[model samples]
Target: MALLDLDPRAVATARRLAERAAAPVIDLARRHTTVSLERATLRLAGITGADHTHRAGDVPWVNRVVDTVRAHCGLDHGAALPVFHALAEHGLGTLTDLAEATAAGQVQYRVPTGADAARAEGSARAAIARGLRAVDRNRADRDRLVADLGDPPRRPWLYLIVATGDIDEDVVQAANAARAGADVIAVIRSTGQSLLDYVPEGATHHGFAGTYATEENFRIMRAAMDEVSREVGRYIRVTNYASGLCMSEIAVLAGLRRLDMMLNDSMYGILFRDINPVRTFVDQRFSRQIHARAGIIINTGEDNYLTTDDAVDAAHTVTVSQLLNERFAHEAGLGDHLLGLGHAFEIDPALPDSFRLELAHALLARELFPDAPLKWMPPTKHMTGDVFNGYLLNGFFNLAGALTGQSILLVGMMTEAVATPFLSDRDLALRNVRHVLDAAGGLAEDFRPAPGGLIVKRAHQVLGEAVDLLARIADDGLLNAIAEGTFGLMKRPADQGRGADGVIAKAEGYRNPATDLLDTGGDQ
Candidate 1:
């Protein structure tokens, strides 16, 4: 149980920052978010993307394509995907571009297959074509497997985390995860992996938390995991974070190498890690564009907010952040399926209605992102060194995930809140989820709300409070709102966060031949 003891102060600091970061963006993004091809095309044509001085980086182009496609396609995610593949080449310049595009026409797009689009190209048009045709073999496979799930399994799926120092060793661990019944496997990045400005090259053997996020590392892990999926005869999702100085590059690598999900958030870097808000936002905008085009699902870090704050009192903050994140993601051309919004069971279990409270929050998240996959995280805030208590908490968390019907259930470890989990520990965690789901698989089906059922009433209560908070955030500047600590107790100034300069404003002239190639014909 000593393995689960993490310093709570750092987590609390993150919560405070999350509040500051999300409050400002909720309303502004909802009101102004749009897709545009170029700045000059706005209705208020002469108005400014001024305060949004931060660059759109790859967003401008992605917005353009989605906008154009929307004009011609339908409103659903499936309708918009194909066009997204087309516009990703242009790259997104800013959120305004995306909002305008959304208002234009519905874009009809598809989940890209390598055969439809090409790879990176020499010309702009060619690059777009190439990126589309280059099929995401792995993604396609995963989607197929998920689609074929026919009926929900007897229980909720068990998701596991793997962070061995070596990719080869990690592969074995991943296989073991699949064999042990893990439905998803997330490869934790090495400590400080996000802070690196450029992506490291080659396979790595020494990682502090997990493994180096090299292209090779991504590819090797994905392939190994796929093998396990085949061996287990069940779909297995793979995950890695697309957050940091190299966000876009990491996304490009993830898509190229066939990753299933990415830990991609719009403001986490700035609020928690001191990464420049502008830089991270800019980087994230591009990465999400790539994610949209690649048909990759991105899990936002809202749950991480509670790691720092009281889960019960801060529940509204989590909901508010999810709203902001949802709007931001949609602006980037990502769809509901692509939004893996995060939440957790971190409230101290001391409260009489604690379990019901967790259920309310989880259900609220699920209802909001009805089409998206909600990622339910395990308890970290209250996990003591007692393994006995730890496992029981994990069981309750697992039950909560199933009852709330979370799409991605990140299993809680008996050794959580302390050191990284040992492989044996991971196995026990997996078994716990499997057992809960197997027994209670039909609980949701049997569930019916009373005139004012505790779960429904509490969930509604949180929503009403969130609506008020969101309205206030919408009126004040989103950035200013964040500074007021709207998310967790954490408060961060938009302009004051780290990595601002790391954001590239897409110099009046910018180009990447390799990126161009991938955009055009690299899919093959």
Candidate 2:
């Protein structure tokens, strides 16, 4: 009678997660924060480094157009998407000012819609006819540089990080990472940048551990990777966290700037950062909507749960989190391609058949979201300074990723627990991954779950347990459930944690014209 084999209890848990998300969704909508057209335009200018003084808000379409322009460009969060939408839509040669874009032009300055699929398609065809050459050109510029980027490919993706403290240093290291066979480059934000409600202006020179996640930083890194990606003859992804207070804003910025991936979790903040569960969920929904629109893949944070709990006993929790994340993303209009569901190889190696158990758990994720770019996480649980063991563990982690068919494999580093990786360390890690993958990359394909095997039985049993937990979460609120210690060995309350002030009700007078216009525009 059931639509799927998952127990009715799992359905119940999913329902509870949705219920917990409901109050926050409605509350955020009701708050209704408003920004003036002039101010929004000004903020937009700063994000893209446009030093123009144009005040065209007096025009009839000024206010309405500003709303659309600002939202598309991330004016609200003080980060501007690098797109000169006004110019692109109009085919104008310059963005000397935003006002010029809204002016009449030969190009269709107006956007197309669901009812006008043919019209949009026609317009797209025309643009491709003309601009296709340019896209190919710019893309070629990136591709040509790819060959110089050390054509090494790790079967599983390389796990990487960024330092907001210094851009030059970050760039040098990022380039080196690519040469060393890193498949992903994640620019860690300046310390506490996410906590700040407003984004900083201009190219930053100084940051703490990583460079500031500014528009310039994004552009700089994107351009850098294009060269590497082309050199390697494969796609190299750029990643940044789109969480915290400015989640929606960052997603918009990331999309417009051509960023490929983001760490955009549903309830990571409330569960870990203490962001109000209502605000986090609501913000996440809106942020993901933009990501879905921009064709950006999102990396969820379910793997963080195991860092605190017993990996063996709490394996089911990871599955539950993935299910919840998938449902939430689907509700937000994300497709399988946009899902980079997260899981880690963090179980202590000392446990019995830890490696085999990991394989079972991982393969289950691969099966669940077969079409998604599953992001297999690196080992963070026991990343002690013991570099030799850490490196071996990472090798094993890489083997799991390659075996299970994870699309976004994040390779672990031996120095994860000690410090940022040294250049030499990265080289060695790459070498390690290459050896295993070359020697045994196809190991998983040949191995099947043993008949009624311990690993298989435990995985199936854990999945059922996970479904039960999801059912409970559905009945209770996800926040209320989390407050009750539903995940991560730690218990955090919805209303009791920090960053509550950062959780603000939208001030009145905020108008999002794009939201209104796209309200009926099906997400796909």
Candidate 3:
């Protein structure tokens, strides 16, 4: 039901440009492994716990293993082969034992060469097989639980965020949100946690804006959601951040916990958090691989671009980024169903024909990636302190979502810019969404643009603009374009960012068990 007939050549050109833009970055990702990648490998080998000797705070065992392996084996052959080889040869009972031994300065790692490489590879494969089995079980459990409980009541599953800064409090809020009609609950990570090189080890009580995204928090919230799922007769899905410096490591934990969705964008950290471009690209590849194996849908961050740039002028940037994100996700082996591509309704309401333009953008996204579970974001950039106007704006946002056929809709709060939403605020928000959805849900079934109308003109205009921008990106290179402030109006150089030090080129013979496993189709 495309109201505007978008140029097929323009779509094809945009895709080709996106592919060209991503090819070098993908090649670079294949040739390097970051410290986070090494840490994720340690995690997959079943390393857990933290070192208690440091006063700054206990360092994760994965960090210790990665540090030790980097110090001894040089990281070219990856941490897995050396760590697993030590486990096999020293008869270490577990990966934690090896970490403890290394910390005690009693163990030395060797980068196997020649015939010794085969033995190391054999050991690493067996350990990874065990880890993959665990992942498979988690995915199977999620399916079985959803099957027993039943799916959400309708399409465009209502998504709500819980940011209480306390895990226990978040659990209560999450349960309430589920009962209040939220189909998915995303536990927002604490402020600045993305910049942290290491994941916090346990459940944390005090955070500034949101709860710490630790494995214990994930476990506790998941258990509460499971209970609520049975009570509500619907499987309440869990979501958490799998972005930032520790992206790959978070993906490992999220997979183990069976999280249903992850905020896993290709360049979100680079554009918003000033993480190094190369580091984020490499990390996202590994993270998406884990997400793909875990059956987790990855919601990208295209909506954030609209916050920093004008929505009407930058709508094409969203489309361009989606194409790049889609390419990158495909490179990581993610199917369309798992690509939760994000867009938003952030255009200024004062603009004439704003509703028509909104529909054009949403419908264009819907038709372009018909199978993707597009995550439609609510209005935020223009929210004033007036709750009544905010509520009305949200009504329009909800109507657009219903008419455009969004797969997931984040409910907007009337008090968005005023304060952190209260439970009552969330309840009102859900009610607003339900009202619009119930009234206008069938509008899309019969919707069609007036021939050569403003909506049809706008969709084609945006697509043409996107194709032009993608061509420029392909010519200039994505890193250079990003450095020139092309996406979010912020210039972050490729070599200068928060996590630049973590990026490292892979040495010859570099081997990651997870990558090897994924390449060989070991995990399904």
| lDDT leader | 3
Model 1 per-residue lDDT tens digits across residues 1-524: 11112234433333344355454443332222112211111211111222122253323333344344445542222222243344453364433454454435433344344534333122233433444444355457657766764323533446688888888988888888888877778899999978865456578899987888877888888778667666766667788988876676677777767787899987777667777555565566657766776788898898888988878777887887787777677666788878988888988898998987787788777766678888888998888878889999999998888777788888888887677546889878888887888788678766544546787777767766666666666557566666776666668776676555422233222333323333343434
* lDDT per residue (tens digit) for residues 208-289 in model 2: 7766776677778888877767666676778988887667656656765667688998778767776666666656776776
Judged by whole-model lDDT over C-alpha atoms, candidate 2 comes out at 0.63
Task: Score each candidate by Cα lDDT.
Answer: 0.64, 0.63, 0.91
Q: Candidate 3's C-alpha lDDT? A: 0.91
Can you write out model 3's per-residue Cα lDDT over 238-302, one digit (the tens) per residue? 99999999999999999888899999999899999999999999999999989988899999999
Candidate 1 worst ten-residue window by lDDT = 37-46
Which residue window of length 10 is worst by lDDT in model 2?
Answer: 76-85
TM-score, cand. 2 vs. native: 0.74
Global Cα RMSD, each model: 13.4, 8.7, 1.2
Residue 262, model 1: Cα distance from true site in angstroms: 0.6
**TM-scores, all models, native as reference:** 0.73, 0.74, 0.98
Stretches of model 2 off by over 4 angstroms after superposition: 1-155, 496-511, 522-524
Worst 10 residues of 3 by lDDT: 1-10
Two-way lDDT contest, 1 vs 3, winner = 3
